[model samples]
Target chain A: MTTVPRRDRPGFYYPKPPATWWLRRPNYVLFMLRELSSVFIAIFLVLLLVQIHQLSQGPAAYAAFVERLRSPGWIAFHVVALAFALYHSITWFNLTAVVQVVRLGERQVPPRLVAAANFLLWGVVSLVILFFFLLGG
Target chain B: MSTRKTSEPFWWGLFSVGGVVAAFLVPVHLFLHGLAVPLGWIPVSPARIQALVGHPLIKLYLFVLIALPLYHWAHRFRFILEDVGLHALRAPIAVLSYGSAVVGTVLTLWVLLR
Candidate 1:
């Protein structure tokens, strides 16, 4: 009888990607930062939700909470979070061009135009918000 | 590898929708609340904002704004951690990440209802 080969026998060695793989390329660094932007945005949302909770507590509590955020350190943290949130938003908008396919007749819509349209919509919405909060107030 | 089907597509679907929502709305919110308000570029009181939040429409808006990005964050962070070489802990990590998002969503709904 022929001897059967064991299934658990040694195979070719497969090298694992290094922990510093992101450091190898600029695009990798950008990708990591983009991924990290979500975390920063999440932190901001948590802070906002906490503020709303304070609001429910009463005006004094809400005013006190907002006052606490005026500290230089907290302001700086918000600044950084804002930057990350903006970065995340921009990258995501750009990606919509890739994920969505729009064809006009037999011709495909250009990705650049798609991205521009996204940016335009973003601008319009932001402006509406600004009008409501900044000027209207 | 086991032939078990994954719920990854479902989670990814949420992430995709959340990404669109976050991209469209989050930056403006951040700019208004974080930078403009604190620096006094816009003169609005806490009471005004509280009243705004009290509206039913605003509550629904906040639910969408706060809840979806959470799952988006969860999914992205899960992959990032995995990429950094925590391959062995995939299942536990997925549970923890998505579970946190679900908890956040519930908290948002509770706060809105209150």
Candidate 2:
């Protein structure tokens, strides 16, 4: 009788499933969420493009587009899309610190720091834009 | 083993720049769509949009804001897929992401110029 290697043996002793297909990894769930958010991003882009096209056409066309956006159905769509986009943005920003190869002379900067900085910078920029728009000019 | 940096420079550059742009642009986007409109401060009108985009400085800013961030987001997304061991899909995803950004840039430039 041929004996299989201990590591290769399929039994309860294995840390993971013998086959990749049988594993339900947490990373898989994350990947799905990230990819699913792309659909929302696409939808948002289409809406923006349509608005841009209308803006180019003249006042009446633009007005019609805006009116359409104000409809309850469209507003609901925007709300859902915004939720997805926000989730995507937050997740992606957090991942940035991990994937980028950042090194210091001796001590490496923490990934959490990078993520925090990103969020802080965003907050500041948003405030600045809001200030400008609200204060006039 | 090949020592050359496997990552594409254009894509990396886009990602870096896009990260910075997105950091700023996203907040502005939220404020514009979320706060301003809700507060009844700025009406969504063609004249308002034209005035916003028509200013030379604002036009330049918008171009950078829209193009760079999209490119950045796409590149990051491709990397996320790669990290998940979806290596087989890498090439196709990279091409699609970069191609879309290029097309978006062209369209945006056309709008700004016209």
Pairs in steric clash, model 2: none
**Candidate 2 docking classification:** acceptable
Could you say which candidate leads in DockQ? 1
Q: Write the per-residue lDDT of candidate 2 for residues B1-114, one digit (tens) a residue.
A: 346666598788987786556545654564465334533457554466677767899778767866676676677677665554555466898988788888888887877677
TM-score of each: 0.91, 0.69
DockQ of model 1 vs. true complex: 0.68
Clashing pairs in 1: none
The per-candidate count of clashes, in order, stands at 0, 0
**Looking at model 2, what is the TM-score of chain A?**
0.71
| DockQ of all candidate complexes | 0.68, 0.26
Query: What does the lDDT read for residue B12 in candidate 2?
Result: 80
